[model samples]
Target: MKKVSLFVKAMGLGLLASASAFAQYNPKASYEGPAKMNTWSVSIHGGPTQFFGDLREYDFYPVGNTNSDSYSERGTWFVGAAVGKQLSHLFGLQLGANLGNLAGMKRRQYFSYFRSNYQQVDLTGSVNLKSLLFGPNKMKHWKIDGYTGIGVLRFKSTAYQLGSGRVQRFTKHNAGDGTVTPAGYEADWVIPIGAAIHYEISPRFDIGLDFRINHVNTERLDATIGGDNSSVYDQVGSRGSFDNTLARKGSSSLDKYGYGSFMVTYKLGKNAIRVKKENGKYEYDTTKGTYHLRWTDPRNLIKPPVILTLEQIDSVAKANRPKDIDPRLLLDSDNDGVSDYFDRQPNTPAGSIVSGAGEAIDFDKYVSAALPGIACAEIFANVQFDTDKNIIKPQYYEMLNKVVELLNKTQCRLQLSGHADRRASDRYNIALSRRRVEAVRNYLVKAGLNDANRIVIDAFGSFKPIGDTSRNGLQKNRRVELRLVP
Candidate 1:
């Protein structure tokens, strides 16, 4: 009893150590973290139990002893249930219980047979073979586990004769060494080792097959000692000195049984299933909320970091960078509406009203002829703005007032195209330029210009720069051009 208690304590400590190790496996990625995994489950199984001992006649079939009344089938049925907890993707623990009957007979050496009904409980550790070898996502719906454990078995056995229906008894005198217990139910230790293959049908349940062999610690399980001489003793367990003539050592062979069962497991907790995208990538927690620890490997769940070469990085930067300013939008040497590329007169006087071709126009003569149905001359000038400022300066007010007077006198229209420097984003610059245009147009309306609708406006942000974006050209680029149309 003390040895069994110490073994149980050792197994408990081992399970706790394993659980600690698994709990500390924190992945770098938060999405692949194991904190939300489903870890608890329950299972039920039923199958046939095959007993192996000294009373067995054949390996799988009871053949030679069938003619004698001592013949007994060596196979019986068993039912069991278990509850498990998955500590990690690679390791788990299960506590299971089984009730079964065992039978075996032999007629060659000894006309003896025994039947036993047994119950056992085990605490086993399971190793996930599938996820350990392949990745978690490789065989998403299948699981294979190998397990081994120690437990206690309690059983009652009855030994009988072939034709006489007489019960066989073994006392301390005839049994030799008194190792065999009296004829009744007895308790002993057992070790179970086996493997299982499971197929997950859904998030909640799984179906699988399990095969295990239980090694009992006692040789009295069949009520017949192994290697007992049949020629010397007419009946089984009939002599105290049988070991002297026995072919093998004293009680060398222990008793064991095997169970091949079909099992169904139900998983408990929120089990997140993986979703496969059209691009052949898998995502967890899209359909369900949390992953099951039984099938999820923390390392495999992490998404690989994207890697790019230097050339690829440079290509992306070039593709998204803002385009260069149009040279034609700049290169106007004079403050005229025309660029130098198209300006016939490249250098006009400052503040001079210029035509579309950059030629200075006679403002008074054009205004007088335009009153007599003569068309008004197209004149252009620029209103400069400070960096990021939408306020029209006092110096440009005089020029604007003259244009307002011309608009009130003649049926002429004013076109204002506003611009800004490249110190800000395109969206912000466009809004600043629009504000500048509105300021100038409001000033014209307050200055008694007729038909405020005659003013047309356009706001072009840093995209259409009239000069380079350097210190000298910034103020020039941040200006509104005024074009008077007939």
Candidate 2:
């Protein structure tokens, strides 16, 4: 038992050591149906086998005497194959068949030896212990499974006297009920229980090591009964019944045998090579290739829900919020070509042609109307509109009236330049600005201006902002700037 415990621990460590070297990338989470994955597989294994029954002398080490006088074969070999299917990440089933030989000898107790050739078939269910203990995310390519199931075994055995090398045949019943007849081949039920560790080498292949112990329903597997325990060497010659009736009379415990084998498995399905990116993420295409069910869990492919704290939400909102318009795009308080940010002459006249540096050019030539064909500095107050509205507001009616009075009184011609806030699309805002310019031009003509042709209109949409574009400052941008031009 101690040796068996140590072997189990070693297998577990091997699984963990290999699994720690790899990691699978988890995809973004959503509530999607499970994906199709490769599930069917085939495995083949073979290894040394040992028998434990009435004819055995030791628990682990076998007696290996092959002398002609006392011929003994204590260890043999077994070969097996299985077809399996994974129903889920945690559970699967396998149908398997094994053919092997069992041998045991006892020189001290009864001076007898037996060898049996057997075949067994079983259907077993496997539980993935690693996935059960750690959620599917851990152990990317390693699997540890515990399996158990029932089978039927058939074996033909012959017991022999050690020195004489003669077959031991039954004559008299141990209980003295009746004469006993020797049976050639025996059939019994068997339960196999074991565990294995498998490592996935790729999408299509896996390799593993497993140890299974089979418990048989009868004690005559070695063709011997417990009644032959007497130290007297002549006792075997007196009563030599190997029949079921004689075997049952001296039955103490069921027979058992165990084998440790190396396994190779091949999975069947359409699987593509898994590629991992430099970012430690797997690149997978569901349309072309599938993940294997033995190593994949549907839940691990899903991304977890996104959760945000109050501070994080606030931070995100602040980062994406529109910033106040640049002061250069907003404020040119003197309507000069240069913005106030770079303007050395911030107070240049509205109608004056200024230098690139905003310094007035030929100021004296403009103030006295001394230059021929030189127009006077234009003047008018701006007309405001409501948000997204093109209608001229009532408060701006008086302002438009005064502009009309001046246009009729002087030779000054009115220039209507309309604008809109940045809240709407550029195309829509341009149309809105045109309508506002036309509204102002119509108002000036209706307000008793003599020549309607004296007014010229231009629309500058949200492209030009003379004020803040923030929520509280958007209103200042929704207006028409009026200037009398040449």
Candidate 3:
């Protein structure tokens, strides 16, 4: 019981240590499905075996003197083969069969030597150490396991006289019954418990060492059950006139045998190789000849909105800004209070009462011109046009009315200057500009101006631009200006 307690404690400690190591290495790990093959293995083992039974001495020495021999003489050889299936990383099952010979000698009162040939079959459950402790990745080259199982053992034993080398066969039948019965050799239940360590030398091959102890339920494995002296002496007679006593001198404990073996195993199924992918998924790469787990987009995982710092915002704002700008041109290019867009007289003098066109007021010129009956001041607006267009817009009707009123009141001739944007060739622009002048002149003549000849037309291509040739500048250039001719 004490030994059993110690063994249990040791197994418990080993399990606890394995669990601790597993937790440390694979904190968030989970079991992946088995690879693309069935997990099965076949193994063969052979090694030394030792037996402990009633016919053996208690001391651990190995000498046979018909008086003081040891149990070490019971050591023999065993060979076996097994097939196993791995159910998971932590557990597996095995079914195996073993054949071996067991022998023992005792010389206390009468010398007796017993030899047995046995065949056993077992089914076992195993705990995989590498998988349980540090996962399959750590099990690449080495593995360890503990196993236990129950099986049936069949054996045949013979008792031999030492000096005469005479053998006596034990009968399995009870002749007291009237009916003749044949007892097949001894058959008993056995429990096999053991541990093994293995090294994988190749993808399909492994070498290992196994240590196992088989405990039998019956004490008659040596052919001596109870300590009945007359029953045994009658069977072999007196050896050299000495009484041959086959009585059991050892304790009434059941028999137990153990084996220490070297084993070789071959995996019988396809290898399950895992391939890793870049996006958290699994796929097989033919070029690399391996399977891998791939990473995937994290759409399933929660993400927070990004919050930018003030410095980052500032950097983005300034990235597209120009390094320098002409302040004078941006504000008032001609030193006029009005900006360039509204400044019709972009070169206005520093101090002058200017109209909204940014031109200096000329009351004397207006009064003088009016006194001569020429209403030149009435030409206050220019007729604008769409790009490359000659037709007059409806909104310009009122402005044209003012021009007609001034022309009717004045005796002076009016001059129309037409211009175009710099979009086409010079000849094309000059033609477009002349058509604009003709359009304005024809409109005025149709609006009841008696002397159509009083209006003179002139055209200028984009060579005479009033501003930079930007979109707004082009629109400004595509116009017809009205001015009184002196």
Tens-place lDDT per residue, model 3, 255-292, is: 77788999998777443233343586534333332221
Clashing pairs in 1: 272-290
> Which candidate should be chosen as best, given TM-score against the real structure?
1
For each candidate, what TM-score against the reference?
Answer: 0.54, 0.53, 0.46
Better of 2 and 3 by TM-score: 2
lDDT ranking, best first: 1, 2, 3
User: 1 or 3: which has the higher TM-score?
Assistant: 1
Per-candidate RMSD, Å = 13.5, 14.8, 21.5
Off by over 4 Å in 3: 1-38, 58-75, 130-140, 168-184, 226-251, 271-486
For candidate 3, report its TM-score.
0.46
User: Which scores greater on TM-score, model 1 or model 2?
Assistant: 1
C-alpha positional error of residue 401 in candidate 1 after TM-score superposition, expressed in Å: 49
Q: Which ranking of candidates, highest TM-score first?
A: 1, 2, 3
Q: Score candidate 2 by lDDT.
A: 0.70
Model 1, 138-252: lDDT tens per residue?
8777899877778898787766666664666331212355554454466778878788999988777899999897877766677666664544344654622223322212344
Model 2, range 35-121, lDDT digits (tens) per residue? 667778999999999888777777777877777545556458999999998766666779999999888876765677777888999
Cand. 3 Cα-lDDT? 0.63
